[model samples]
Target: MLNKLMHSPSHKSILRLLRNSMASTTPMAHLLHDTARQHWRLLMLYLLFVLLLSFSEACLFATIYQTMRLLLGAPSFTEIAGFGFTQGQRLFLLLFLISALQMVASMSRAIAGILSGRFAASCQRSILPEIHRYILSLSYGCVSSFKIGDLSHQATLAPLTINTEIDERIRLLTEGLLALIYSLVLFVISPWLLLMAGFLGFCIILTQSWLRPRIRLAALAVEQQRRNISGTITADLQVLRLIHTNACQEDSNRRFANEVEVFDQKLKKLSNLRSLLEPIAELLPVLAAVLLGTVSWILSDQQNGLLIPGLATFVLALQRLNIRLAKLALSLNALTENQPRVEILNQLLTPSGKIFRRQGGTPFSGLKEAIVFKNVSFRYSSRQEETLTSISFTIPRHGMVALVGPSGSGKSTLSDLLIGLLSPTFGAILVDGKDLQTLDLSSWQNSLGVVSQDVLLIHDTIAANIAFGSPVVPSPEAIRHAATAANADGFINRLPQGYDTMIGEHGHRLSGGQRQRISLARAMLRNPEVLVLDEATSALDSHSESAVHAALDSFSHGRTVLAIAHRLSSIRHADTILVIDAGKILERGTHDELIAARGAYADLWERQVHGLSRPHLHKQL
Candidate 1:
């Protein structure tokens, strides 16, 4: 039944995770449904074990009731004699045995829980990489709609919520099942006792229904805040330096503060609401018991009554059970609240329409041929406009080709398309005269060497950074050699640990130039056929720029180079310069040829040189 419901077309497709509930679904029903689907084997095993234990639990409950009855019967002195145990002592011993049984139950539960935990974690481990691969596999158009920070939080942060929920579901399931069984037994023992419980049940059911919508709304609020929080922090941290440089630190701080404050307030409100509801929940059983006692008193005499003390004790048991059932009903909302998050995780785990396989291509296989683009066009999914129009170009075999353009003129878009990071809205790219769409994308891309404006380095050794791109990481000696080629050897050698030194998160300890060099070294270690350098020197000082450029000269030899040059001077010596304007190649030739034509290329070049030379021409471009 659970599997059938989960697979139904009406159920929202699980997203590769996005938020609390999936993009579509009510949380409680979704979580319960999803949990049933996700952990069927565990649930079945747990249920079987619980059923065995319930028999034991029922024996314990039934024994207490019978023992009290024996005491009330007022037997002879032999039964009442306190030699081994008094009346209280006998009952206490039974209670102690029940407590011992619970302890045994707890131990077994721990072992079972550990097994379940390992299973879920293993499933998650297998699923996480697939999630990552899905994100990596998405069309750049689809990916651009997401922020790396938010995705990071979702992939790492939000999934932690699911982990907690998994544990809670187990905890609640046991408690709920035991309570349910115990309550049903109480009702069976004395139906008159259940009369009071019905009132409590009515109250519990009414409250649970009302709170479902509200709890879901609160969960939705919490999820929204969490998603936005990561993005806000990401943006602030990225431009931290700019904040100080422009003296906008105060304003940025205020924005961050506001975001956090709002987040805290929402959390507090949700907490307060849950707390306020607790008393009402507790009073349900008490009110039902009081009503039954009042009616029982008026309806019959105590000495010869249908509702006697024994019956009242039974009613009290049922009342407790009713309250427990009420608690279980309330907890079911948490599952709902967690539904969106689970859907997102499920969606992430779900197979996608976007497949990254390469088409009609030979593997880069020792750099035998050039990278080719037949006719290519691309637009971001979120953005209304196309970033690259129908354009065709090829990087010659082992030759340097430069792409020159004004900002947002499709240079980055082309590089992304060539890398299989984005698919063409309308055309194809080829590697070695074979359609790239037909080849093994990850395997093919594994052979590419790309260096971009963003320099990402992990918290690891300099050696690790230098050998990051290659499928088979180089040895220590190999890492040093690659570093030497990138002109990163000097600074690396100066560090206390030499090649073994760690670079903190974002390579924060290193200078910008140092970080860029390390990134370049990593690419060199890969020893790829296709080399792409996108604005490699755009942020460097002249001295650093020259050093990196010198390193590039060594690296580019015997490789096909695609350079997206920000400073026109850098690409002047390139084998071919493609001047791009409005997502199309406006001019193609040597730098001097483009200069002679005096088209967009000449306009941009003239503006760069003339604008920097004097302030007046800067606005002209």
Candidate 2:
């Protein structure tokens, strides 16, 4: 009989349904599925415990039916099952079986709970690092498109949501199995009661289906509002100084309050919708009981003694089924609400959904001769006009090349291309006559140092920040040497903690010139073969600029340098200067030679020199 049931079409169908229900095509679902397959032993053990729990429940229900029969004096044990036992013996055996079933049920439940918690912890441990690594691997443009708050939500919260979804899915499966077992037992006791119970269950499912879309919509609204609120707060905090200087505190407060109010409204609506499922679920068993009693009365023609025991057992099974059904409904609702978060995580983790930087196989050691750009052009993906157009330049080994251009004239874009942060949309960049795209980017970047106007400093000691990204941690001596070369040693030594002083977030505690010098120190510590400076001294005062220029004069001896600057004085001694305007290089020569030509470079030099001569006049205008 057991074999026949196992091989039955209905049984096969049930197995297929459960399998299909668990399988999903979403990226997060795929990750969890792969994780589960890797830990199949634990998963199988968990299922075994669940099955044991169901068996204990079944045994408990059977014992209840027997106890009911004994209380009503329906039949002796010998008459019912041909057992040669006295009434007292039969009663003792039934009570002992009940106790044993409860013990088994408790043990199985506890074991299953422990296994599930461990599995969740393991999944989280494996998933977080993978997400972080993938985020780091994404192309610069792709990552920049996300707001800080939105990206934070994706990285920290989305994985947690998916993990919870996995747990809820398991619970849904368990409840489904338990519900099926109870239904089967109800069918055996009384088919008429089982049919009524099935009808009531169908009603509950229909009600949940009606509520599902509304709850999901409300959940989406709440999630969107949450992202908005987080983004607003982060943006506000980051620019707190600006707000204070402008005296916009009242406006900022009002804006934040409005956002919070909207979030509260949406969150309240979502809560109200989710709360509907529980109360509806709780009301189901009462309806089932009423219907079961009515059906029993209608079938009163049957033997009262047999009917009473059967009716009692049928009600017990139906009540258990309803509880499982309600739990299943709640799990489904929770999964529905988290569906949007799952989709966001899917987009983030899925390769096809994100832009990943291309990696090459060939390793690069160091520049041999020159870095050349051959008719390179670049347009942002969202723009119609190219940012850099057909630009070409070369920085020979140990040579100093400078780029001077107005704002939005492609100077920084060119530097980004040289640094490998961005790839040219057309043409090619060659390092030692080899295509830049064909060389390993990591190897190429490791040999280059970059310092831009906007310095990035973490909240760490001076030495730690200087040595942050070096392939090898530098010794204290090396760090000091780099700082001295950047002209930052004096200021750092003046600090009470010296190299061990903790900078505040983004190094906000430091002056602009101090921050720039630390950034330069970080770049110099790499001992790079090439140094690319993007207006590195633009924020420095005259004294600091002179000090940095003095350091650069000494430091540029054996290194190839690419300098992009608006202050022409800094690049007056560069070996070659390229004047760029409207995505094109209008002039290329030494600064002195360009001045002699009296062209665009000469005109810019004249304007800057004139502006400095009459600073008050320029400020007034």
Candidate 3:
């Protein structure tokens, strides 16, 4: 049966789509369908209410039409069985019963709203946390590939937007079903009028269909523009101090304004198309009502007996039918409008073979012997040049190794390899005689610590930021001890709130030296077996650097330390110094030995000693 389906053209297309959905992100239809299936009992209950509401609406409209007929004095056409009352009394009682039924229908609708709202909230609760967890689980490369703005939108805003859209679509679906029932009743009243109204509805649908591609394109454009705008706004805010210092605020403002203008233009185009759709959806329905009423009156004149009653029924039914069709059209428009955002969310949430983060390897313990890079090479997917080339080296257990090189010479790339952030493209990294690939990275990471140039702190208490990744929050004494080791406790104690002081965004409230020390304290808090320091103290003043170095000396006694720095003063006591140039280690020796040898490391040392700075000389001096 599966083979036959695969061979059939129509089934092949469906199979291909299913395969695509499985391999990549699920399509919107599948997402909705899956969500509905998860809440099947509640959805079914909601639908029952919707059905009751629709039935009540049909009954009430029919009752009104009957009441009009009896009051207009067209008697005895289709009398209620066993009711012996006069037409006036019959009409009054019937209207009263229909009014009560209408109230019941309203109450049912209210109940359905509660159920749907709860279901929608549940969907949000499920999807938001899941997406956040998935993001955290992604490989460092995958995480870094997305911008902060884009990730923020995906994690924070997209779930809410998607849930709201889901609610709207579900509501629309129920309304559409209700409209169908109304259309059926109208068809029974006057087939000709019903057919004409359906023709108008079909035209409305056709117009929306024609506008779909354009609107969808516009939606995509707007979504992209929104990301760009978000990125721009974020970038501008982050660089505001630099812009002001350089006296380029006008230039920055103009650039941001231009982006905003472009976004505005795109929005205008989208709105124009949307507005065009609305009037067309609305106008045709009104025309249908006018034409149907006119036809009913003319038909009433041609038919002598019971004409008023029939005409009244047809007119009321047509009115109800028009309402349902109009609502259906609007629902479709809303779905189309939200397509781009949904697609963006789908891409973020989708787990694809090509993009999935690697998982499930042998659990790793702390490094016992050494981390060895054997003939390691790496090239980014977007670049032709290899960033690291045959970078063979061994970081001995419980040793301090300094990587000294200019920018773009693969110091950070090599560090990334050491941290298991990037895997070797053409070689293997071994830890304790086992391939890094075989070791559980998460476990390995837990045993590792890092202090980099840019320290990231959340807008929370200092203690929280220092104890960010630990499964359990560090105790106050532990926090104080780590801070003392990092030479940060003195200043932390001086703060208004002491250890409980709230750090502003990225610890902007603190000085550069303070932030760096706090970062060091964070690294120390983990008591990592392996520590990587990439220009960790470059922001510190001389006194602060000395204090931090003293703290690090105590911490580095038994830990494997991989330090990357340009300041020759800091690594004077390193056990081993590797001087890298153009993706290869040209020299490796102790600080004193490399100086005596007068090689690449020697040249860098001399330059730093003389306060001469040359970033990267392609040719050896």
Number of the top lDDT candidate = 2
RMSD value for candidate 1: 6.0
The CA lDDT at 2 in model 1 is 20
Ranking by lDDT: 2, 3, 1
lDDT of 2 by residue, 1-621 (tens): 111211223223223343345345445655655555545667678878988998899889988888878877877454578887788888888888889999999999999999988877776776667677777888998788889878876777855785677668778878998998898888888787778888888889989999999998998888888889989988998899899999999999999999999999999999998998988886977777877877787867877887788788887788888789888988999888988787677667666646777677579887889989999999988899999899988889999999987788889999999988898999999999999989998998888889999899998998899998897979999999999989899999999999999998999889999999999999889988899999989888898899888887777779999999988898898999998887899889998899898777777787788743334322221
Of 2 and 3, which scores higher on lDDT?
2
**Worst lDDT 10-window in candidate 2:** 1-10
> TM-score for all predictions?
0.81, 0.91, 0.90
Ranking 1 against 2 by TM-score, winner: 2
- Candidate 1 lDDT, 1-621, residue by residue in tens: 222323533232221121232333533234334544465566556555655565556655565554555456533232556456566766666567667766666665566666667646744654456447656655555666668777776677433555556545655666676777666665765566565566567777788788777776777687778778888888888777788889998898898888888889888867766664667667776776677667656765545333353465566566556656755765676675775566555554443444433344545464567666777888776678888888887777888889987788899888888777777888888777777776777777887898988888888888877877679957888888888877889889899999888888788889998898888888888988788899887667788788878878877888888899879988888888987766888788888988898666677787678863323422322
For model 1, the superposed segments whose C-alpha errors exceed 4 Å read 1-49, 74-134, 157-176, 297-309, 343-362, 366-370, 540-551, 595-621
**Which has the higher lDDT value, candidate number 1 or candidate number 2?**
2
lDDT of 3 by residue, 1-621 (tens): 111212223223222332333222254444544454455677668778988888888777777767766777654334746557877678778779778988988999899889888877777776677667768777887788788888877677655655656566666767887778778777777788778877887898899889877888887898789888898888878877788899998898899899999999999998888788767876777777777777777765455446666666666666666666667666667767777887787677555632445587988877789988899999986689999999888889998899988888999988888788988889999998999988877888888889998788889988888888864578988988998999998999899999899988878899989998889999999999999999999999999999898888889889999999989788888888889878998889898898898777777777778855345532563
Question: What RMSD, rounded to one decimal, does every model reach?
Answer: 6.0, 5.6, 4.9
